[model samples]
Target: MRAVRDFASGIVHEVNNILGVIIGNAHLAKKSSANAEALEKYMGEVRDAAEEGRELMRHVAVLAGEQSSRARPLSLNDLVINVTSELDPPPELDLSSEEATVQLDVWMAREALAGVVQFMAETKAVTSLRVATRVVGSAAALTIEDDGASPTDDELRALFAPFTKLDGRPKVGLQLTSLADLASRSRGYVTAGPREPHGLRIVLTLPVSDGTPSGDRPGVPLSKKGV
Candidate 1:
């Protein structure tokens, strides 16, 4: 199928990027052997890249239903906070006050969200990003908005289509397609539309476990980091 091929192409692209990191860092490590600090830094980068490649393979396995039994109930709010905090330039968070625990594989969900955020942050046209969450009916919605050049409806559709490449923005198509695939596996859905005036809005909704408010509402702490 075309979808499968697009997914494969995207995976190859991502794997190439990871391998570039590993190879570049390895060479740096070799060259910096005399400088203990530089050598350690390069080695660390190489190790991190290798671990990322390993995780990517695991993600592929999970997507193929080989490791589909690893999901658990987790607080969506907490996961969002934890993952976003680790981003190089963390996005602004306007998270939900209520805790919405959902059944999900942490790695899959984390990678989906992080990949999107990172893509947006790296985009030359995007200026700002805001992430928010809300419990809508039986599902929890994680929405990410960006102040960037708004895509037309046709463009938006292409972004969510698996393997649908975009001009100079193939990564967007790849990331969102992977996200759509993962959401489908969990009985969730992804929606995207042009934001008012300008920019784009994307929402990922997943069913919450029991739909009960388990814990006290957390305080809203704004992260004022530049994107």
Candidate 2:
């Protein structure tokens, strides 16, 4: 009962935050009507917020068992590079390196990872980021480490549960929750905590792929994460 309440509270917190971004951006867009450049910028933020809201809804639906998991064999390293390469990271983040191929839902892996990276950028003055892979038992673990910002013990405890957020707000951390669920569905897991004396580390583990890569060329549609 307590756990359910906490999860509900976390979801409320995140939805409120995402809506706040949309509202704030909409106000800015309204106020910037006089400047074409500013209007465009504000409108872009508004669009981002709206897209985020839609994505959040989708994630929540999946978390609630409203969607099916489409998974396949994939190179974890390849998938990580594919997703991260498309996004612009924080200016200070030095992510240049790591790897293992695994079998999992590529969309889940991409969303789970990209969401955490973006959330970290929003909530922390990140100085550096490190990503790599390691073999853990029968699983291939995708590891992400940051050299700035830290989460408390309580935040760490709820990192993987549905409705939990790393920044402790209502800004939609469903990505991380989905990651945990995704890993579980693949017969693996996800874990996070403090790293050394600074920063944090998050690992999403999935079953290693025993097969070879598909023949699809690069820059294929989003379906390439896994067929």
Report every candidate's CA lDDT.
0.73, 0.67
For each of the candidates, the C-alpha root-mean-square deviation to the true structure, in angstroms, is 6.3, 5.3
Error of 2 at 58 (Å): 1.4
Task: List the pairs of residues colliding in candidate 2.
Answer: 13-170, 14-170, 14-171
Residue 70, model 2, lDDT: 66
Error of 2 at 144 (Å): 0.3
Instruction: Give me the displacement of residue 140 in model 2, in angstroms.
Output: 1.2
User: In angstroms, how far off is 105's CA in candidate 2?
Assistant: 1.6
Clashes of each: 0, 3
Worst 10-residue lDDT window, candidate 1: 218-227
> Which candidate comes out best when scored by lDDT?
1
Candidate 1 positional error at 62, Å = 4.0
TM-score of 1: 0.68
